[model samples]
Target: MKFLFPIFALCALLSSCQALAGSQAGTEAKFAPETITAFAKNVEKYAAAQGAGAFIIGRIGRPQQELPKGIRFTHTAIAVYSAITLKDGSTVNGYAIHNLYQETGKPDVSALVVDYPVDFFWGVHELSAGIIIPTPELQQRIIAAISSGKNKAVHNPAYSVIASPYNNELQNCTEHTLNIINASIYQTTDMRQLKANARAHFKGQRVRSSRFKLMLGSLFMDDVTTRDHDGKVVTTTFSTIGRYLQQNGLVKHMAVFNRDGSSGELL
Candidate 1:
């Protein structure tokens, strides 16, 4: 297990999605359940106050030090404000996170999961959150994409931690989020054209791990791979996505929502 540290570390830094490589990566919770629940509610309240209908939410699924130079979040998902029915049959307004989670045992595959904020932060490494509130038009577009089932059309079950955003050869959480947004904007499920648009306008975060370490990680973890990427490992990250939306005037606001009730600039 000691020798596997380097392999896991490489995966953690290069991965744009959740920490799914090591045994405890996705299962361990840094804060108590009650504390996480309170923090999750706080994030939800903050987004609601901003009038965010649909926004991007990011979480740190691994220790901060394990993250690389340009990466801040280990996982990202789309959160939509909607009415949720409780176990007791009562309904209330809350945010529902749409995520691409690696199957519990099958790390190479993923599934679309709709969960609440508390569940979203239950297995996190930190209480902080990355939020990107899309503009009113884009928010409606995103909600439409999800409701029309276009989101599932763009999902690739063959998961990769460092999937290229410019192509659909493989898919990760961030890429899926981008795909859904593009589907909404372009009003099409054409993956090829969506990817082309991304290549033209979006600049992905370059992965800085060495090839030797990358290869080592691929040898051990099913979700770790750089094969789809040719030379430089450029994949969509939460920050890059925020910048893309901001530059295109599709974002209403973006910020880092911390547990201490303070906010910081996202870009």
Candidate 2:
């Protein structure tokens, strides 16, 4: 799902809340302990309804708006839910949910908090084709264990759940292996070292044929290598291979590779 905007906004708002709290002494505090505790119980109930091994991971609560009768609240929580199967061929479904709340601004200002709800709940009889499926006997045991409010069942080893679409995309790219050879090269003045690093990293990976042109930019070029299935390296060279490396926490900069083997644009 496209959760980028919402997640980013939530993170920013949460950070602002923390900054505001830190700046003022006793100016704001998290939600009441009783409210958080009740939220936790409700999370467990939600997990149990979904046949999940429920457990709360984290929580943050804050006061939002104050009404004449009670206080408005915003909270964020994380939970883990799981299903397990035992060795004796029994299955159990379980869930865990955590709830957190935080006050946005001062005592009675417009407050907002981000909720991080992670559900690890899965069911036995609700198996989908091509998805991870536990054995029938294992599923039964999991169901039995969760029904009794006990979490002792062992989950099936083959029951791999797909967390998200990005995970699936990464898994599907099994043909080529991508790696970062040198992150510091982009900051260096040496062109030869950068080229050498790129060559070493890109060699012997099975990349798509059409990606060659897209890989060649003015600043950096990609080296394509073809190898046999037996792990034998065959050919390697600087090719216009079109492959983009998408990373989360990397410092990205564009550099220029001159025709005369010079390096420029170190930014």
Best-fitting candidate, scored by TM-score: 1
Put down candidate 2 lDDT per residue, 1-267, tens digits, no spaces.
587975665554333332212111122224344543444345444334434332212111222221111111111112334454557899754333222111233221111121222221111011110111122333343334434432211111110011011111111011110111122213332434434554554332232222222222101211111111223222211111111221222212222222233334312
Across residues 141-252, which tens digit of lDDT does each residue of candidate 1 receive?
9999999899999999888888889888888888889899889888999988998999899989998777777777787778878889888988888999999988899999
The lDDT leader among the candidates is: 1
Candidate 1: stretches off by over 4 Å: 1-26
The C-alpha TM-scores of every prediction are: 0.91, 0.19
lDDT of 2 at 184: 20
Candidate 2 deviant stretches above 4 angstroms: 1-29, 54-78, 81-267
TM-score of 1: 0.91
